[model samples]
Target chain A: MAETVLSSGEKIFILHGIDADFRNDGRRRCEYRSMEIETKLMPQTHGSARLHIGNTDILVGIKVELDIPHADKPNEGKLEFFVDCSATATPAFEGKGGDDLATEISNVLIAAYQTRNAFDLKTLCILPHKKCWKIYVDVLILQCGGNLFDAVGIAVKAALNSTEIPKITAATLDGGEPDIELSDDCIQLDTSNYPIIITLCKIGDNYIVDPTLEEEVCSTSSIVMSVLPNGKISSVVKLGCGSIQFNTFTKMLQMGEIIGLKLNKTLMDVLKEENQFGRQRRIFGFLK
Target chain B: MPVDQRRINGPEVSVPYHIYSDFNKKSDKVKHDFSKRSDKRIDSEIRKIFLKTGIVSQAKGSAYIEMGNTKVVCSVFDPRELSNKNGYCMQGEIYCEFKFAPFSCQKRKIHQQNAEEKQYSLILQRALEPAVCLHEFPNFQVDVYVMVLDNAGSSLAAAIMAASTALANAGVPMFGLVTASTIGIYGNHYLMDPTDTEEAICNTQPDNEDDFNHGIITLASLPQHNQISEVFLIGSIDTNTIKQATEILTAANKDICPVLQQCLVKTIMKLHNEKK
Candidate 1:
C-alpha cells in the first residue's frame, strides 16, 4: 500500500473535516467517490472486471475449473480468493513486502463470502460428490489510493456477476464410470446475494466512508463490514491500532449495513445496464 | 489433523481447457505453410509498436508500450537512499522488478514472481544498466518496476524498451537510448517479433531430428553507440543460424530506435507544456 506522510496540522484538518461530515473533497460522510467499472476486459479469464474507485485500481479475474469437492462438503463447490498486491502500486510492495497485506485482504474476503446467505457455494456443484466447479477469484491490486477493501469487494462482485460458467450438457455413470459433457452455452453466476465490504475509517469522533490516502493517515482505527443486499452483515473486522467504545462499534456496524445495501443495489443496476448494452458498451481498462 | 502451514496453498495444477482448445483450433485453422507466417507478416516484419512515456503520475518517470496485444508499463521512481549502505560506492544501483499480470497470458500467472519473471527482471536490468550514468547518484538506488498487462509475445523486449524510456523521462542521465527486439528461428526461416501463437509453434519440438534449429533470440542494443548490451537466446540453434538471427535482431533494434526517441521527445514536450 502507498503511504502518505501528513503533518500534524494536515491530520487535524482531516479529522475536523470528518467531524463536520464534510471531507476535503466535499463528499458527505457516507458518500463514496465516483467509481468506474468495466467487465469482460480480460478475455483470457472466464470472468473479469477492472474497477477504479478514486485512485485505488483493482482488476478481478475469475477462473473456473472442475475439481473434486471437499469431503466434508461433498455437494458444494469452492470459492477461493487470491489477492496480489503488485509492486507497481508502490516500492514498499516490492518482493514479499505486500504478501502480508494481500493475505489479510484475501482472508477478509473468504470470511465474508463463507456464509450460505452471502454466497451459495452449492450453486457451483456439477455432479454432487463427483465433480464441482471451483471458482478462483483472483484480485490484482494495480494501485492503492485508499479504501482498498471497498474497491476490492465491488470488483469481486462485478467479476462474479459477469462470470459465465460452462453449462453441463450431460452427466452419466455408465458401467460405474462417470462421464460428463459441457455445452457451449455459459451460465451466468447469481450474484444478487453477493456481499460488498464497507470500510469506515474512524476520524475524530465520527466514522467516514471511502477515506482517501490523506484521510486514512488521520484515522485512528477502521471497521470493515461485509453486507449483503438483504442488509445482512456477513463479517466484521476491526483494523488499526486504535480501539473504539462499544457504542461506537455498534453505530459503525449499523452505518455500514445501510451503506452496503445501497452500494450493492447501485452496483447491480450498473452491471445490468452494462450487460444490456453488451458489445456497445465502451471498455476503458488502464487506457483511460 | 494438523494442517501444514509452512507453505501457502498455490494454484491448482490442471490444463487450462479453454486456452488449450482455442490454441488447437487456431493452429488447425492456419495452413501449415513454411514460407508464409500467420498474421500475413513477412519473415522479417515486426508487429506495430506503440510507445508513450510519463503515464504514471506518481512515479518520477513512466512509460507504456504496446506491441500488438502485448502491453507493458514501466515506471521509474526517484533515486532514494540505499537501505543496506555498508560502504559508499561510486556508482548508483538500479533495481528492476518485472511481473506479468495474472490474466495477461493464456495461463493465469501467480501473484508471486516466478522463475521466468525473475530471469526477465535480471535481463532487463542488464540491458538498461549500460545506458544509465549510474555514478551521478552514488549511495542511492533507482527502482524500475515493469508490469505486463497483456502478454502476446516479445514481452521482455517490450519491457526493456519501456524501462529505458521511463528512465530517460525521469531525467536520469543516460549514455543513449536502449532498444530491444526478439526473433524466432524455425528451421531456415526467421520470424521477427513473433506473437504468442507464432512463438509457440516455433517452440514445439520438431519430430524430424535434422530440423533442430528452432529457438528465440532476444537482443538488447544501444543503437546510438552501435553496441549490443545483452543477448538472451532460448532453445537450441546452430552457430551460423544464431549469427544470422543476431543480424536481423540488430537491424530491427536500429529501426525501433527512432520510435523510442520520438516517444521520449513527446513526453518532454508534454511536460514543458504542462509547466507553461
Candidate 2:
C-alpha cells in the first residue's frame, strides 16, 4: 500500500469531484485513461508484452517448460504466476515491502484464469499423466500510477496471445519410459476467452473506475472484478480497509461488469490489429 | 563402494490409502441429486451450528464454532507494541494466522503454511479489519489466530464467524459484530453451507457444456451496520446468480447474528454469577 499524504482540503476536493461524476482528470465516472500495449518485446522468452496506463507501466514475460502433470489433474497443464514489484516503482516496495501486494495480485490472476472458460489448461497438456508443458508468467511492475490489477490483467492476456509453443513432432512409449520429439514449427495459444479485470473505487456515494494515484487515497473501498470476454464474471474480490453497503456493493458489481466487457473488446481489437502486421510492427521499446 | 543413487531414496510418489477403499468407489463421479443433500438437508438449509465463546483460558478472548462436521477455533491475543516499527502510524494493525491441523482434511497438511492457507489468512485480515476499531490502540497490533480442527467445507466462513466472536469476547472495542456465510452454486441450485463433497462437485468444471456457471462465494458482513466487510467469489458465474447469491448470503449472515448475541449474553451471565 503506497501512501500519498494529502491534506484534508485536498481529500475533500477529490471526493467532491467524484461525487459530481467528474474526476480530477478529464475522464468520466466509468471511463479509463488511455492505455498503450506492445507485445513480443523480449526475443529470448517465448512471449513478452509491455503495458502502459498513464504512468503505470507493467512488463509481462512468459516461458514454457516441459514437466510432469499433477497426480490429481493429470489431464491438465499448469500455469504459475509470479509478480515482482521493482523498487524503482516506489520506495515502499523495497525489500519485502511489496511481497504482500505481489502475492495478492498474483493470487487474483490465478483465480481469474482458474476456470475452463477463461483458460483451457488441457490445451497445454502433452501426455495424459507423464509429460506436460508448464507455463510460467512473470509480471514486473515498473511503475504504479493506480489500478494495478487491471493493468496487470490486460498485459498478461496480451503476453499469452503472443506466446508460441513449440510443436511436438512424435511421441512413443519406450518400455517403462516415454520418448518424445519436437519440431521447428510453433503454434500459438488460444486467448479468446481470457478475462480482463476492472477495478471500481467507491468514493462518497458514487463509484468510479480507474482512479489516479491521488484519487486512490480518497476512496473508501474498491472492488476488483475479472470479467470474461463472454460477459461472465470469473472472480470478484473486495479490496481496501472499508465496509460497503449491500446496495452499493451490487451497484458496483453491475458497473464493473459493463466496464470490463468494454475493456475486453477494446483490448482484443488492439491485439488483433497488431497481429495483422506480423513481425512488421514497429518496436517502440521504452522510448515514446 | 558406492550406493545406488540412481534408485530413488523413496517411492516415486506416495498417495493416501483411503482412495482405494470401497467408500470412495460408491460415490465416484455420481451426478449429485440437487434436491436432497447427502446429509438429508435441503438445498437452501444450512447445517446446525454450535457456537461458544471463552474456550481458551490463557488467551485474552477465544471462541469455538461447529457447523456440522466443520470445526474452527479462534483466539485473539492482547494488543502489543508493533513488532516492526515502520514509521509513525495513527491506526493500529492486525496480524492474522490461519492454519489447519494435519488431520483436518482427508489429505495430510504440512506444518509449514501452504499457499492456500496464506491466502486465507490474508482474506481473514481483510474481512475483520473494517469491523474492528483499530484507532483505539494506535501503534499497536492485535494478533488473531484461527485453526480448523476439522474441515468438511466452508472452513473460511466458519473461521470468520469464530474470529469475530473471539475479538468481542476479548472485550476489544469494535464498531459492530461481523458474521460470514458461504454458498455453492451448481447450475441453478444454491447450496447453503455445502459439505465437502458438494463443494468439490460445484467447483469442478460443468460436465455438460450447456451449463458453465458454477462456483463458491464467501461473504462476510457487519449485520448491525448493514454493510459488507468482504466478498470473495471464485469460479465462473454470471451476473444474475451473483445478485441472487449476494442477497441470500446477506440474509444468511443476519440470521446467525442473534445466535452469536445469545452466546455472548450467556458468557456474561456466567461471569456475573461467579463474581457475586
**What TM-score would each prediction reach against the true structure?**
0.53, 0.96
DockQ, structure candidate 2: 0.49
Model 1 ranges with Cα > 4 A deviation: B1-276
Cα lDDT over the full model 1: 0.81
Highest TM-score model number: 2
Report the Cα lDDT for residue A113, model 1. Answer: 81
Cα displacement (Å) at residue A137, model 2: 0.5
Tens-digit lDDT string for candidate 2 (B1-276): 011344444454566666556346636554677877899998888899999999999999999999999999999999999755477678998889999987999877766676778789989998999999999988888999999999999999999999999999999899988899999987888999989888888777764473478889999999999999999999999898899999999999999999889999999999999999
Q: Top model by DockQ, which number?
A: 2
lDDT of 1 by residue, B1-276 (tens): 012344536644544566435655755643357677667888889999999887899999999999998999999999998877245766788999999998999877777776567657766777787788888999889999999999999999999999999999999999999999998777677989988877776654354353355667787878887766666665445445656677778788999999999988787788789999
Measured against the native two-chain assembly using Cα atoms, what DockQ does each of the candidate structures obtain, in the order listed?
0.01, 0.49
- lDDT by residue (tens digit), candidate 1, A1-288: 565779899888888887888889999999999999999999799999999989899999999998888754567898898899999998878887887577658866875786565677778887776889999999999999999999999999999999999888998876766689999999998887788888998888899999999988887578776776766555555565344553465577678777887899999999998999877667776796
lDDT of each: 0.81, 0.89
